[model samples]
Target chain A: MSTRGQLLLLWTTPVAGVLFLAAYLMFPGFSPPMSPTMTPEEVAAFLQANLTATRGVVIFVNLIGASLVPFFACIAVQMLRVGNSSPVFAYSYIICVGIGLTAFILADYCWGVAAYRPDRDPQLVSLLNDMAWFFFIAPAGLVVVQNLCLAGSIYLDARPKPVFPRWVAHFNVATAVLMIPGAFAILHKAGPLAWDGSLSFSLRLATFAVYVAVMFFVLLRVVQQPVESEGVLL
Target chain B: MAITTADAEPLPDTNGNTTAPGLVPGEASMWFFILGDLLIFGVYFVCYMVYRGEHAGLFLQSQRHLDQGIGMSNTVVLLTSSLFVALGTEAARAGKAARATRLVGIAFACGAVFPILKLVEWLPKLGAGITPGENLFFMFYYLMTGLHLVHVLLGLVILGFVLRSLRSASTPNMKFIETGGIYWHMVDLLWLLLFALFYLIR
Candidate 1:
C-alpha cells in the first residue's frame, strides 16, 4: 500500500474508538451498567423497553468495533517490518488479537440475540446479557498477551533506529499490566471489580482508547517514512 | 570530597543537560516510562481512594486483616534494595565497574526477596480464605499489590541484565544500568504509596 493508503488504514484505529463510545452512549436509560446484583426482572424489563435500539446499537458495536482487527493487523505488519527475520512476535500478536477481537464481536452479537426477542424468559435474557458482558470484558489475558508480544518485539528490535520508540514498548507493557484487574471482574457483583465496574470495564476501556490514539500517531510517523528496499520504513 | 579522576571524568550525556551534561542518568526513554507509569498508578490510586471513601467501614475492617508486619518488612526490603540500586548507579557513573556490579548484585538479592515475602504475606491470607473475592477492599489490595508484584519481577529481570552488562562489557553500559536503576527506584516509590494507602493509613 502507498504511504497515504497505509496511513488511512491506521485512522481506522481511532474510528473504532469513536464508534465504541457511541455505542456506549446508546445504552438504554443510560443505566449504570447491568451489575450482576441487578435482578433478572430488571434486565428483562431493560430488554423489553429498548429491544430495537439495543439490537441496532449492538450491531453497530460489532461491525464498527471489528475495525480494530484491521487496525491491529496493520500494526502487526509494521512490527514485521522491524522484527528482523523472525516474525514470531508480530504473528503471535496478530493471531491473539485477532481471536480476542473476534470474541468481542461474538459477545456483541450475544447481546443482540438477547434483545431480538422481548418475549423470552427474563432469566434467559439476563443470562445472555451476563454472558455478553462477561465474554466482552473477562478475557484479560488475551489483551495481555497481545500487548506483551508487541512490547517484546519493540524491545527486541535491535535496529539502529527502532520501529517504535522504547517508551512505546514500556507503555504497552504497562498497559498490559494495567489490564489484569479486569479478569477479577468475574469475582464481584457490584464493586469496582465487577464486570462493568470502574477498574475492570471503565478504566480498561479508557486506557485502551488512549493506547490506540497513541499508537495511531506513532504508526503514522512510521508509515510516512520512506520505505526501504526490504520494506522496513525506519 | 577530594578532586579525583572520577570527579573530573565527563559524565555520559544521556539527558541532554549541557552544564552538568550526562548528570541525568539512564536512557531518556526511561523517563517516559517513569512518568507514564506514575500517571497510570496515580489513576489506580485515585480510584482506590474513592472506593475506599465510599466503603470506609469495609475498607477499615479489611485493613485490619492485612499483616502489617510483613508489609513493613517488605517496605524495608524494597527501600534497601533501592538504596543499593542508587548506589550502584553512582558507582557505574564513577567508572567503578566492580563496585557497581557488587552493589547491583546486592540490590538484586534484596529485590529477589520481595516476591518470596509477597508469597509469605499472601499464602496465609489465601489459606485463611481472604482472596480478592472477599470484599472490595481486599480486591483492591490484591489487585494493586499484584500489579506491583509484576513490576518487581520485571525489575529483577532488568537488574539481572544490568548485572550481566556490568560484568561482561569492557566498559559498563551506563545507560543500561541507569535505566534499570531508575525503574527499580520507581518500583520502590510506588510501594511506599501502596504501603501507606493499604496498610498504614487510618
Candidate 2:
C-alpha cells in the first residue's frame, strides 16, 4: 500500500479515540458505570430512567467495532516490518484485535438489548446488564495478548533501526500488566476490583487511552520515514 | 543473528571500578519498565491508604490475620536472593562466567522458595473461606499480592534466561543480564512496600 494510504489509516486511531471519548461522556450510567452491587430493580430502574442516553450509546457502540479497524490495520502494517521471518506477530495481533472487537460489540449488544425494553422483568434486565458489564470488562485477555505480541515483535526486531523504539515495548508490557486486574472484576461485587471500581474500570480505561495516544504518535513517526526496506507484507 | 560460543566476547563489568561514573545499571528501556511498573503500583498503594483511613478498624483487624512469621521469612529469602543476583552480575562483568552462573543459580534457588511460602500462607486462609470477597482489605491483599506474585514468576523466567546466557555464551549479553537483575530488584522492592502496608501498618 502507498505511504499516504498507510498514513490515512494511522490517522484513524486518534479520530476514533477522541470520538469514542466524546460519545462516552454523553451517557451517565456508562462513564461512571452502574454499580455491580445494584439490585435487579435498581438496574432496571437505571435503564428506564436514562433510556434515551442508553439508546443513543448503542449507535456509537455499533460504530465502534468498524471505526477502529483502520487503526488496527495500521498497527499490523508496522508489525509486518519488525521481524525478518514470517510475520506471525502481526498475524496474531490481527487475530487478537478481531476477537477483541467482537467482545466489545457483544458487550454493546447486551446493553442495547437491556435498554430496548426497560419495562420488562427486572431480573431479566439485570441479567443483560450484568452480561454487558462482564463482557465489557472481563475479556481483558485479548488486549493483553495484543500488547504482548506487539511487544514481543518489537523486542525481536534486531534491525539497526527498529520499527518501534525499545521503550514502546516496555510501555506495552506495562499496559498489559495494568490490564490484569480486570480479571478480578468477576470475583468482586464491590470495592476497587468490581466492574465499576477504580482499579478495574478507571485504571484500564486510562491505560488504554494513554496507550492509543502513544501508539498514534509512534505510528506517525514511522509513516513519515520513506518505505524503503522489505521485511514482510500485511 | 545467531551467536556462537566462540564468537561471544567477554562480559562488561557493571561494577563502578571498570565502568564510567553516572551510568544506570541495565538497559535504559528496562529502567523505563521498572519506573512505569512502580508508578502503577504506587497508584494502588495510595488507594489502599485512602481506604484504610476510611475503614481503619476493618483494615487493622484484617492485618492481624496475616502470618507475620511467614511474611518475615519470605522477606529475608528475597533479600538474600537479591544479594546473590548483585554479586552474580558483578562476577559476570568480571568475565567469571562459571562463578557468575553458580551465584545466579543460588539466587534462583532462593527465589524459588517465595511461591512455595506464598502457597503455604494462602491455602490455610483460603480453606477457611477467607477470599477476596471477604472484605475490601482481603480484596486488596489478594489482588496486589497476586499481581506481585505474577511479577515474581516472570522474574524467575528472566533469571532462567540469564542463567542460560551465562552458561551457553562465551561472551554473555551484559545488557540482558543487567536488565534481568534490575527487574528482580524491582520485584524485591515492591514486596517490601507490600509487607509494610499489609502486615505492619497497624
In candidate 1, the residue pairs with backbone N, CA or C atoms under 3 Å apart (3 or more residues apart, or in different chains) clash, namely none
Q: Write the per-residue lDDT of candidate 1 for residues B107-164, one digit (tens) a residue.
A: 9999999999999999999999999999999988999999999999999999999999
Q: Compute the TM-score of each model's chain A versus the native chain A and list the values.
A: 0.92, 0.95
Tens-digit per-residue lDDT, B73-129, candidate 2: 989999999999999999999999999999999999999999999999999999999
lDDT tens per residue, model 2, A1-234:
347777878887877987889767976676678899999999999899899998888877687656878887888877877854667899999999888888888888998999999999999999998888878874587889999999999999988988888998999999999999987898999999998899898998888888888888988987766654443354
Distance from true position, residue A162, model 1, in Å?
Answer: 0.8
Top lDDT prediction, candidate number: 2
lDDT minimum window of 10 residues, candidate 1 chain B:
B1-10
* Model 1 complex DockQ against the native: 0.01
Docking quality band of candidate 2, CAPRI definitions: incorrect
State the local distance difference test value for candidate 2: 0.88
How high is the lDDT of residue B144 in model 2? Answer: 97
